[model samples]
Target: MASQNDHFASIDIGSHTIRLLVARSNEKLEIYPLRLERRITRLARNFQEGQTLKTPGIRESLRVLEEYAGILKCHGVSDVACGATGVVRKAGNGEEFLAEVRQKTGIAAEILSETSEALLSAKGVLSVIPRTEGYILSFDLGGSSTEFLLLDTRREKPLWHTSVFIGAATITERFLSEDPPPLEAVSRAVEAIQDALAPVFQAIGSILPAPPTPFPLQVVGTAGTATTLAAMNLKMTDYCPSRINGLPLTENWLTATIEHLVRSTLALRREIPGLEAGREDIIPAGALIVREILRGLKQTHLIVSDAGLLEGLLLDLIEKKYGRPQALVSPLTWRMQKG
Candidate 1:
């Protein structure tokens, strides 16, 4: 069992941003994230012709890692796990970049396989949603990739999983060349998404069993893209997970929201509730991605989950090293650590 004061950490180095989560698992079987931080590094922006981390990207990432290392040391983190996503995995020079990162930070980062990443994201999002019996599909849209997972509640197992290389950031860069993208360009982007998702849809159709009638299939949305959309739908002035998570979003509302987002300018988007400053540039692309996902799944409704990979990593660490405890830990303990 982990001691009351023992600290653990997980870092997710993504294409658009790097996130670090530090948590403490107490003797009472409680795990709380003590500190969380994210920095936008745009690592994938330079991965144009090939999978290579640009010189500026490398320098930025190294600086962030140096700072994060200091923070971990200050907090006395004992067990640490770091992982890289699309940019690193797809880059031709990924191995060399990762080697340098390890040498500099003393943290050997694991590049999570697409399936593994999908599963971890599903596990994390599921943890936050309302427990129910039926099939659930989880979607996580990122900067350089999008992951899909089907979870069978009846069997308590994942049924299917896949990662698509198309994401809001990447798609925006590819299609939104015009200040306000032309209608033709937008249509082309949609067509491209449909083409890319054909295989994923086929895979889902093949593996997912027919659901029992009367119980609608649940679709869960997580990550920055989903959360931001949920926030916009709810008309929040600022992002608040407590207000957004598990909130029901109907298909009609989703469609209307996407249309509204597509028609709005960046300046107008910034005025909308719950849209932060940094997200204005990518919100349109993100909204389009969400709209396509709903269309692909034939989903009529969605449930938003604010939690994802970070929480999943925490749970896995607890279960793997510390045996399951008999008593339940207070949710407040976990809540307090979000700072």
Candidate 2:
């Protein structure tokens, strides 16, 4: 078995960003992060229109991955897992892209299915929150899709999970034409989000008690969209992930933020304290999607989690190498849920 000193790394190549996580485990098998990096390459840019990743997007992703691989090598990472989500899964030429990526970067990028993305995201959130008395519902909003996981500690694993096609990049491309989108564009985007979330709402409503009955639920939000929102809420001149993680954002704040974002021009939004350079255009759609989710799900507040799929990937490596760590093994294992 690998000892406490073993270094490990995880790479998550998503539609809008590429991230890397490097960590080392302690005696108890709990890992501590050494470095976390995110580079916005917009891998899904023009993918819907072109049906293939654009050349500039592919080149940028390769550059980022090559740098990440070098970082892993320098750290002498003993175990590494890399995966691509949403964009790669949808692109018709995704396999060809992956081949070129592997040949250039020496990192095998597995394309994760929607279900796999959901589970990994859940694992990532649970790794941080551990357990909640009531049921926990978490969402990972990506550039191309939003993944959901409902975990009921009373049960063994997640009660249910799903992936909706509505996402920041896709919605922005489909609904909004002008920067600081006009009222009509905003309405269309909101309607699209509602339509996408209808089935999820239906499923949850059927499972929960009728209105006026208090639902035993807590909502958690993960991935880029949620964390970025938390950063913006704090209005930090320099975003600190430590402050963002486990932060609670109220529905009122989310609604207000959406209004602010939708009304602001892309240039103005880019000037926001925590807004990143490349996300100015798509953040309005992302903010709106988050607000609708809070309202539709009857969630008053959302706990923001910075630890997500990358963290989950590291935990999975630990579980596979050593017997499952207590932090990782739920009342129900992920494999059992599949069976």
Candidate 3:
């Protein structure tokens, strides 16, 4: 078994950003989150016409990884797990890129398949929420792809899952071509999303047994897009998951919020309550993608989950090494690190 003081880290190399989390696990099976960092590298932005990560994208990714490596060292991280999503999974040169990243960062990076990504995301959301006995939909919207999974809380397992190529960053680049996009541009984007989601919806429909009654489905959204929306809904001057997570956001409020965002300029988005500076440029695109997903699912409300792949990965590692938690990592540790 890994030692109590051994430091473990997980790095999520995503299309829009790279995130690293460092934690220490104790003999009592508690894990304390120590450090968190994120860098916006836009690794998928330069993908060539054939869906290959361009030379420039690889170079930028390497630079970001080198920086993250330094941070890990400072935190005394010994065991590392890293994964790439979306662009790398689809790129022809993905394997080659992964090799280069490992060489430069001294961290082996695995490219997760679509189904595995969906499962991990679902696991992360479920880890935080109260266990219920109904169907739960978990969605993670990254820069280049969005993953959807249907979890059966009754059975405590994922039932159906799929990954869609449309995501906040890519869709924005594809559809919101205009600054404060024209109404037509917005419509086109929505239409495109609807078309792309049709197959997924049908696939889900085939797998899910008809509801015995009209039960209100619980929806959990993770990743930056969801967190941004939740923060905006709360009108928080500063981001706080304690205030935002699991908060019930009604459909009317979400619609109103989206409409308000669509009318504002990027500069103005930064000034708005709950909107973070790093998210200002992409929030509009994210809003559109989220709004369309809700519309497609006919969902009126969703619970935001700040916990995601990182937390999921941590849980898996802990369980494999030491079984279920006898004691949780100190909440004080989380507060201090988050602050």
Give the number of the best model, judged by lDDT. Answer: 2
Report clash pairs, candidate 2. none
Superior by TM-score: candidate 1 or candidate 2: 2
- Per-residue lDDT over 1-339 for candidate 1, one digit per residue giving the tens place of the 0 to 100 score: 567778888888887778788888865656777887878777777366365778898889888988899999999988877878777888888888888988998877888888767777776776667678877888888888888888777664577788888887788888864556777778888898888888887887776666646545788888777888888778888666677779877778867776676677777878888876677767777777777777887877788898777666666666555765311111323554342
Steric overlap count per candidate? 4, 0, 0
How many Å off is the CA of 12 in candidate 2? 0.7
List TM-scores for all candidates, in order: 0.90, 0.92, 0.90
Off by over 4 Å in 2: 211-215, 325-339
Tell me the lDDT of model 2 at 167: 85
In candidate 1, where is summed lDDT lowest over 10 consecutive residues? Answer: 325-334
lDDT of each: 0.76, 0.82, 0.76
- The prediction achieving the highest TM-score against the true structure is 2
Q: Candidate 1 versus the native: TM-score?
A: 0.90
Residue by residue across 1-339, what tens digits does model 3's lDDT show?
777777888888888888888888777656677877777777877453357887777888899899988988898887787879988898888999999998988989999899878877776677666667677888999988899998766564577888988887787778774667777877888888888788877886676677664544678889888887888877788666667668776677777877777777887777888876667767777877777777777778888898777676666665555555422221112323421
How close to the true structure is residue 264 of candidate 3, measured as C-alpha lDDT? 78
lDDT for model 1, please: 0.76
After superposition on all CA atoms, what RMSD does each candidate show versus the true structure? Answer: 3.1, 4.7, 3.4
Error of 1 at 139 (Å): 1.5
What's the CA error at residue 179 for candidate 2, in Å? 1.6
